[model samples]
Target chain A: MLKSRIIPCLDVNEGRVVKGVKFQNLRDAGDPVELSFHYQDQGADELVLLDVTATRQERIAMLETIERVRQRLSIPLTVGGGIGSIEDAGRLLNAGADKVSINSAAVRNPDLIAAMSARFGAQCTVVAIDAKKQGEIFQVLTRSGTTAEAIDAVAWAARAESLGAGEILLTSFDRDGTRSGYDLPMLSAVTDACSLPVIASGGADSVAHMVEAFQHGAHAVLAASIFHDANMTVGEVKQQLTDAGIQVRNEW
Target chain B: MIQIINTGVANIRSLQAAFDRLGCTWNLTVSPEDIATASHVVLPGVGAFAAAAEAIDQLGLRTAIIDRINHRESATLCICLGMQLLCESSEESQSAKGLGIIPMAITRFGDGVKIPQLGWNEVRPLDNGPYDAGEAYFANSYRLETAPDGWGAAETDYGGTFISSIWRGRTLACQFHPELSGTWGESVLTQWIEGITC
Candidate 1:
């Protein structure tokens, strides 16, 4: 049986990890490579790096950061942010990213998902959806949540999967950075709508929240602030999941 | 020097980075001459089996690789799809023929389980293998029925037990990506390199 994955997401700007990570023995919290290695040592099943800085020059810098990080760690690394074309996905995959996530661009051009999957295989293409709950419907947001589209979130997830997206990174704008818990209703809707693996992102307050996400049908749970602030360690989260009878990759 | 066969399917940079960390000299080559002269060869592949097999044949590397691994004592390591390419053929694409060095057929994880068996899983070494059983990262939908006899086969459980790694004579192949597996993976590569050099 395949174990559920616990991933730590790092936002990188100008090749440096933003929102400084607090680790006791970490010499430089700004270095993405060091931070990734730190998280891997803490038993993170995988790492996700979002190139927040999408400029051409910064993209090159992000590639260099990926190479450095790839050299040090063996866990799967998924890179996202500003991937608009097959060329963009190619550059990242060649730079050593095991998978590339597509978000805003995917919403703008649905064919981009199919193209990437066709070129790099579906396993390498991940579709990230940022959905915000409106009156009675969930609206898909783009441009880092500044723009909202009329597309239904649930329907979009199913469409993305049919278009060859191997995985879905679902983030709830309503719950992001709130630390309350995952948006269970929204997560369950998306997971139930698609057979593809859904990675529940956005709000993750505690270990219990992760277990709940898993119960809600999430194949993986991704948290950034909780890990960045040192509110909890990856080892602790894995232990909690194990105690809850969820199978996780046992690193320790 | 180790020559990594480039099938133009995916990047070999990560594999190169792995070798660099171990202080090993390696280069990416599609030329048969480089492959013929090298003491060690690593074939790293991705994408479809038909496309990759076509690339190997077009580059004239199929004959060169088979001749070296079968005739000479040069150590050869195949990773992921490259490992699948060592068999008689694959179910990934019809009309795609493997190197035929290993007498096995590759097939996909059928209905019931997820297609692409992604993420990390525990690998158990068989028959007094050098390394201990450890967790390794895997990302493929297809698998081999059984590893050839006399090969040090290592199995990993997904829906059922499958051959994850195999070592026979100078030929070694792994269904998982050892270069991207982390510390344990790096150690495995180091051991393979040492086995060839020392």
Candidate 2:
């Protein structure tokens, strides 16, 4: 009974959550730890904190944020962004991140995926591919979707799985921030191309969008703005998903 | 105090946090002496099976772990890859050997289901097990297909039924990570910590 996971992705810049954050219940909407507690209280299956910090000095802040959040939050926490090496991944894991997502670094040196998987275990190594529709095919985009690597997203996902990635975080660049819905064709292409479990990201603004993502072969659904917009809680999303006939972990 | 054997890989910090939440005093150590004599020893591991098994052997904790698991005083608990180590061998690493305490083998899950089965799954108690039926989070590709003799088990289904947990005397080992499995997992830890397993 592997239930579909509902994850709330938070952007942690300089250790504080930033961008599109409008939590009604949170007094300090920027604090990563507090925001994590809010998500946990809402019965989120897991939390993904992307370290959107630009400077190296801000790295320590994200680590501190992870440690603080781990001290209280019991659900699994995944940290991504700015992970350029095995050391970066190790630091986040030591700081209490259950998994580390790599994008540009993985694209630059595909071997890094194998290295991370070897040292930490494949279960903790996630290869995130931000895909943008380029004519008939989806092109892999990296560096915050500023660059296209000329690699087909589906093929890259297969390569990542062969290189020992435990999971794939496939985000649609075209649909991100638009909230129109997930790029279903691109998501299904990646999931169908690889055997690893896929987490569908980007353009998830409604419960139906999430349901469609699951139906399109997503093992988990990751949303940021939908949850941060203060429109709904993770519990309500899970409840609706359950009502829609999707299996989810029941809250105790 | 529970002394956790440092496998040198697993997410020990988060495991420590779980114990702290339970109000239990614990410490981390790779010392065989500590594991051999501690009131309760925890073997927590994440990563490759061969690597972990080799680490235990190289650290000289193999014999101590076996001795502890056989102890009548509720001595040991193993988690995830820790559970695989109790078995004699695993398909994950054909050349490497497990601790060989349990008479069983580990193999990869069959196709038709996602490999390295991740996310939350139900753990159904067996033989009047300590905890009630509840779901627990899992992140494993290899699993024990059948229950070993002289042990109690709780199984989970994905591609097929696999033993998710096994307990004998005062010792327990789980394929699913109890530390990350939410409340049902916490209750599992509480039951084991208090030596309340049936």
Candidate 3:
């Protein structure tokens, strides 16, 4: 059986990791390579580095950072944020990212998904959807969740899959950074809509929440604040999941 | 020296990074001469099988790699699409013919099993290969039905048991990406390198 994955997301702004990740052993929160190695030691299945401000110059810096991080560890590295075109994804992949995640750009041009999948293969293209509950339905949001579209979250997921997207990184805008729990309803809707692997992002406060996300059909669970703030370790989370009867990687 | 063949199908920087982390020296080469002189050769590829095989043949690496594996004592490791290219043929691209180093055909996962069996899966070593029975990361939509006779070194199950790694003489191939499979992957790679150099 395939084990559930635990991925920690690092938000990079202007070449530095932002939001102040406070690990006890890490003195520099801005060092992405250092933090990534530390996370690997703590048993993170994968690492996601998002350039929050992916400016023209920042993209270059992000590539350098990815190269540095890639040299330090052997785990899968996923790079995202401001990936608007096939060129953008290519640059990241060439820089040593195992996978590239596209969100706003994919929303703007749905066909980009197919183009990327065709060029890099679907396994390398990850379509990240930021969605929020609007009225009676979950609506897709873009531009950092400030702009909303009429597209239904579930339908969009199915469409992305049909377009050759290998996986979906579904982030619930309503529950993002809330530390409450995953939006089980939205997660269930998207997972039920598509057969592709679904990675649940946002609103994870405890180990139980991760288990719930798995129970809701998430193949992986991604967290930021809880892991970044040093509130819980990846090992503790994986151990909790293992104790709950979930098969998790035991390397850590 | 370790020579990583550049097929232009995927970036080899991650593989170089893996060697760098291990404090091992390697060269990225597309030249057949460099491949001929190397003690170990790594053929790593991604994307479509047809494209990769085309690139290998276009670059004249097919003859070079086959010669090294068949004649010289150099250990050759084929990864992912590189492994598929060693088979007889694949259903992915009908017009493309594999190198036929191994007399097996690659096929897509059958119905009821998810295409692109992604994530970490257990690999059971069927022989006295370097790899132990452990979980390694895998990302592929197709697989071989069974191991190629005595070459079956490791077998993994997704929809059913399939050959994940094969070892025949000095040649080794794996369907999973060891460079991206964390510590377990790194150790397996290190062992392969040692087996060749020592």
> Which candidate achieves the best TM-score against the true structure?
2
| Number of the candidate with higher lDDT, 1 or 2 | 2
Alpha-carbon error at A193 in model 2, in Å?
A: 0.8
Q: After superposition, how far is residue A97 of candidate 1 from its true place, in Å?
A: 1.4
Q: Order the numbered candidates by TM-score, best leading.
A: 2, 3, 1
**Highest DockQ, which number?**
2
Q: Of models 1 and 3, which has the larger lDDT?
A: 3
Per-residue accuracy of model 2 over A26-142 as CA lDDT, tens digit each: 789999899998888888888899989998889988899999999887888899998999999999999999999999999999999999999999899999999999988999999
Write one digit per residue (lDDT tens) for candidate 3, span A125-237: 89999999988889999999889998999999999999999889999998998989999999999998898889999899999999999999999999988888888889989
> What's the TM-score of chain B for every model shown?
0.93, 0.97, 0.94
Q: Report how far residue A76 has shifted in candidate 3, in Å.
A: 0.2
Q: List the residue pairs that clash in candidate 1.
A: A74-B182
Candidate that beats the other on TM-score, 1 or 2, i.e. the better one: 2
Report the TM-score for the A-chain of model 1: 0.98
DockQ score of the complex predicted as candidate 3: 0.73
Q: Give one digit per residue, the lDDT tens place, for model 1 in B1-198.
A: 888998888656778888988889998899899888887899987667888888999998998988887753677888999889888889888688888887878998766665577787888887666466777888788898676866778998877888998876667788988887778888778777776421
Model 3 chain B poorest ten-residue lDDT run = B189-198
